[model samples]
Structures are given as C-alpha cells and as structure tokens.
Target: MNTEEKGLGSWTEREREELLELGHALFACPELGFQEVKSARILEDFFEKNGISFEKGLSVTGIKASIGKKGGYHIALVADMDALEVRDGENAYPFHSCGHSIQTAVMACVLKRLKERGIAEKTGGQVSFIAAPAEEFIDFETRAKLKEEGKIRYFSGKQDMISKGVFDDVDCVISMHINGDSGGPLFDINSTLAGFMVKKVIFRGKASHSGAAPHLGRNALHGASLAMDGIAYLKDQLPPEAGLKLHPVLTSCGGTVNVIPEQAVLETYIRANTLEYLLEAGEKFDRCVTHCGEALGIETEIINTTGYMPFAQSQEITEVVHRQMLELCREDQIVKNVVSGASGDIGDLGYLIPAVQFGFSGAEGRIHSAVFSVGDEENAYFRTARVAEKTVEAILSDPSLQVKNPDFQKKKEFYLREWLGENRE
Candidate 1:
C-alpha cells in the first residue's frame, strides 16, 4: 500500500522496533488495576527517554503527557495501562487478556511519531497522551482501601481522572479496544457499548455449630442464594430492548461446610443499553435482594458504586475517523454501528466530551479469558498507532473543528448525582 494514500504515514525502522519491544515488555510483566507500579514506571521511562515531559501518579498509577505547543483545540488519546486478572485451572495471575498492553504501546508510539513528524505543530493543535488505570474494575478491596485513604475517589480510572480535572481542557478523546471476532472488520468504528452499575451485597447473620445448634444460626448463605434466585426471576420482566444484563458472582459462601455461615457476599453488575433502563433495573435489583434478606431474617448491606455510561461517539468526529479508517483499510474491513454487550470506562468520558473509540482486530480469544493473545503484532501495535496518528491529524487539521455534545453537561450532572450520589457544586 502506498504510504501517503493509505494514511499509514512513514515511520523510521527504529520507531517500529521500539514499539514492538515495548509491547513485548509490557505483555511479559502484566500488572493489575490501580497497582501498576512497574507498568507506570516503564511508560514513564519511555517518555523521559523520548524527551517527552509527563506527569506521573495521577489516580495512583496513571500518567499524562502533552504533545505539540499550546495553540488551537486539544485532543486526547487515552490508553488504559492496567491488566486483567484471569484464572485458569490451577494458575491465576494478572494478564493482558484484554489487549491493554497493545493499546498502551500503540498510544505511546503515536505520541512519539507525532513529535518526530512535527504533526501536532504543523496542525496547530495540542494532543494529550493519557495512560489511565483500573479500567478492568477488578481488585475491588484494594480500590476500596484506596478510597478510604483518600488516594482515589472513583473505582474506574477515567472517572477518577475526570474527578481530578485531568480532562478539563481536553476537547476531544479517542481510544480503542480489541475485537477478537474473526468475522468482524480489521477496524470497527463508532461502536456503542452498554452502561452499568456496580453492586456488592453483604449478608450478615449469627454463626453457630451446624450439627449442635443449627436453629440458633441465621444462615447468610441461604439469604444470598435466595437473593440470586430473586434476581434470576426478573429476566422476563426486563424489556428486550433494554438489553439488561445481570451477572452475579458469589465471592464468599461460608467459612466451612460444617459451620453455619455468619456472612456471605455477592458481587454483581447491572448493565443496560440505556441509562434510564439501567437505573431502573438497578433499583429493582436492590429491592429484590433486600426483600430476600428480610425473608431470611438476615441483615443485608448493599453497596452501590458508580459504573460507566453508554458510549455515543460524536457524529462529526466519527465522520472524520470513519473517513480516515476507510483510507487505512479496505471497504469490507470497516465495520459500523457495532454494539457490544460489554462495558468500558471510556463511556464515562464520552458523556462529558466529544469522544470516539474504535477497535483493531489482532486478538485471538475471548476477552478476559486465558486463551486471549495478540494475534498480529503489526496490526495491533504498529497499524493501530498509524490510525491514531491520522485521527489526531484530522482533528488538528481543521481549525474550525468545533465539537461538543449538547447533552454532555446534562448527562454529566445526572451521572454525578445518580450514579455517584454526589451533589453538584
């Protein structure tokens, strides 16, 4: 493919080699969310080596670097740096099963190339490279502790970043994920994802010896099981268009099989295509679980945490990205209107700014699975950076590129109040 016509742009051989090397290094030493000490340091080292000034330790393990002199509009390229915790058989460790390593490597390369080519200066716009943390929403106990210590406010990385005003000056945002489906395009554009609310239910009861004093014990395990059943019965009540999803995992059932359980916990997420339906479903779930606990005469404590919102890419910005994507791949290699059942923190950012997220197909297994692996390094690492570079160029090239969602602040207010239960200042 002709470099200019394909929008691939030209990168030095050294640049390509460095990107793959970084990718391999990141993949080799995967770290979990909010605890990516080594991963953040590695990216910080890369920035320092490239003469790129950056701010480290935002949201504990997040980093931000700026490219191009301050001038016109500001665009941001966000890359989540945390890995997922996946367990298989007898082995379990933090792994890049979600392709975040590839995303981080590509984002770093994009900033490097933009600086090398003077693209940002020529286009007269500034670009921010944000390495965000805790996108996977795992390691809840640790995150809760961080919140208690006042080190972090939100569970998701982007939400915490927003709360800290990290994105106050950013006019537009772009990011990407991995699509493992072989039938899908090499690049999926303007795809939408569901929004969700996090739920943690703890059932408290008195413990007693199973065989000696069973009547004296109020079994929390029984209460949790009954709650799960109540939630399951709501499947038919949920509207089909709502795309409601309820998945619960029993984290703790009992201390031992012979003891009457004193406490049990259930962690779950209530997801829906629309925020209205999501909130409604979440309320019903809370009610259902509370009633289940009351029926069993056990005390239930419900902890509701804010989650991501539905993702809607800006039409104008999406058009710019779609045209550039067409230039980079064949017509058949571009997929539109892609909607997935999964959720992401990017959706939270999308509600506040003009944002667009795309995907590159270089993953071989289902997301969050042990078999997930990077299938094509060229496509995943190098080509993705190329597309990102072109997208930034497109945004910067137009000086009159005024982009904003009219409903952004309205949704932001609601998100703060409803999901976060925070009064607006």
Candidate 2:
C-alpha cells in the first residue's frame, strides 16, 4: 500500500534501506554493556551526517541530541545501544539475541525521519534522542569496576544516565522493544512489569589437603551448596500473586580436586511486582544465605545493589500510542494490557516520567537465547519505525500533553545510599 492509503507517515525508499542496513550492521557486530565502542561510533556517524548535534560518551559510548525550542516541554526518545553476551544463532561469541540492535536502529530512524519531515520545528516542544548503554543486567564485574573508579554510579544504562542528569529536562519518554514471533500481533502495549535487585554472595573458608588433613579444612563449596538448598526450601513461602522470581547461580566453586575449596560465589536477582513484596522476599532470602554460611562455619558477605523499579505506564501515553499503532496494524493485530514477569531498566525511567515501552513482533526464537534472531526485517525495521515516529509526532503536536508525577519515583541518591552503600564515593 502507498503511504496515503496506509495512513501511517511516509518514509523514502532510501530511508528504509538505511535503517535496515544499519540494523544488520549492528546485528553483525554485537558488543556487551558499557563496551559498545564500535556501535556508538556507527550512531555517531549517523547523527553527524544527518546534522544532529550530539554529545558522545555520556556513560561510556552513550549519545544524546536535542531538537526544537529549548524552553518548551521536552520529549525524549531513548534507545538502548548495547547487545547481549549470549552466543549467536551460529553459536559464536556475542550476538544481538535480545534484538537491541533493531531497537537502536529503529529509534535512530524515527528521530532522523522526524527531523527530515520538519515535525520537530512545527511542534511546540523540544525533542531529545538518547542512545543509552548497558540496558541488559550483565557484565556486573565491569560495572563494579566502573563504579569503584567513580566513573559511573549504577549498573543499568538508564539509571546511570539519570544520575548524570541526562533526563532532567525531559518530560515524556518513548521506547520500543522487540518481542518474540510475528504470529499473534504486530504490537503490544506494556501494562506492567516486575523490578528486581542484584545480590552477590561470597563464602570464605580455610583450605587444606583433601587426602592428608581433610579434617583441618573448612569447605566453602559445601557451605554454598547448603545455601542453595536453603533457598530452594524458602521458595515454599513465596506467594504466587507477588510475582516473585528468584534464580541463583553458583558462579564459582572448588578450585581443584586435591584441596578443599576455600572460596565460593553465588549471584542472583530477586524480582517482584511491588517494592513491598520485593523487600519482604529480599530480606528472607538474605537470611537464608547468611544462616547457611553460619551453619557451615564459613564467613559470608552479601552485597546488595539497586535494580530497575516496577514499570507503570501513563494511561494517557498508552492511549496515544495505541491510537497510533492502530493506524499501522489492523484492529486484530493490536494487543492491550500485556503484563510480563521480566524486568527492564526502562522501568526505572517510567518511575520518573510518563514513559511507555511498547513491543513489536519481528523475531522468532526465545529472547536472550542463541536462536533468537530477526525473522522479518521489514516489520523489524521500517514498519516499527513508522509506528514510533507517528507516536512521537502525535505527542509533540499536543500542547496540553502533560505527565502526572507519582509519589513512588524516588530520587537516585536514595537508591545509591540504601542499596549500593554510596555517599559520594
């Protein structure tokens, strides 16, 4: 169908090609959180060529640009720039299994197309484009090192950017995530999502010869195993409605067969739908790990870190995006009130602004897995860009559009002090 018949905004054939080409380029060369040097350079080139003035390296390769009047209400469009550490569909090194490459390309295309079409100049508000890094909660060691160096204060990209005063002037925010399979619907509006906290557990014990003086050794591996068992038993107390999810992995165990293991490490994420339930479950979980270490006579240290907040979308924003989505897809192809147990740093943005993250179906396999890939490039690139672009246009045109601030959106320092033990380094 032609642009007039389709009811969605128009984009040139060249624009479509650029978006798809960029998407594929990003997919071919995936990088982990806070390490997206080449990925950031690609976007920087795009912005420079298109005359979008941007500041580079906000949180290690993050980019931001603004268009429209300075004093007007600001509308922000954000895209995560980092990819996953999972093996690709070919079972190679790192890949874009989480579809962040597509997401980033779509956001860039949306902003570029809007600028080319003169929508920002006509609108009364300022529009900002933020290419954020480290959305995925992986690479904890790298994030910790950055934190210790006083380079960053948080693990996730959005939180780090917020701390750096990136979104201070922004009012409304929009983001798109790639969902699994283009089967049931082309688009979905997120109704809600769970938030989580990170925990790193270390068990220390004395090491001794396994055969000669086994009685003198204190086995830390045994202590970690007992803690895992206790955590399994504690699952019985988890209420189903709280949407609690606790998955712990033993990252390090014994070193060799001849010596009793002196150190063991465990890492986990505690997720829940509400802060009250999350804290309740978190405290209980801490007790389980600590008591297990005490029972085994091993020293234990549990470090708590803040995670994304529970996602709550503005009803008005959802209504606006839903209307724009209907123009792109048929009524049957639109899904509403979708809830997921998964967590995202976008939820942290939602707490501060009237933010909404919608999903588009273009991939086939399970998310965050090796087999996940872009099954339909057309839907993933051009079509998805159309929806996002139109939504931004609609919101920018409305002068009365305003977001209601909620009480639960706490300051960034609260999280740093309460969870991360931060007080200006």
Which model scores highest in lDDT?
Answer: 1
- Model 2: lDDT of residue 200: 90
Point out where model 1 deviates above 4 Å.
1-8, 181-184, 202-230, 248-267, 291-300, 406-413, 422-425
Cα-based lDDT for every prediction: 0.85, 0.82
Tens digit of per-residue lDDT, candidate 1, span 326-396: 76678788878877888898988888898888888877788789988877666677667888888888778
Estimated TM-score for each candidate:
0.85, 0.86
In the predicted model 2, the residue pairs found to clash are none
| lDDT over C-alpha atoms for residue 413 of model 1 | 74
By summed lDDT, the worst window of 10 consecutive residues in model 2 runs over 404-413
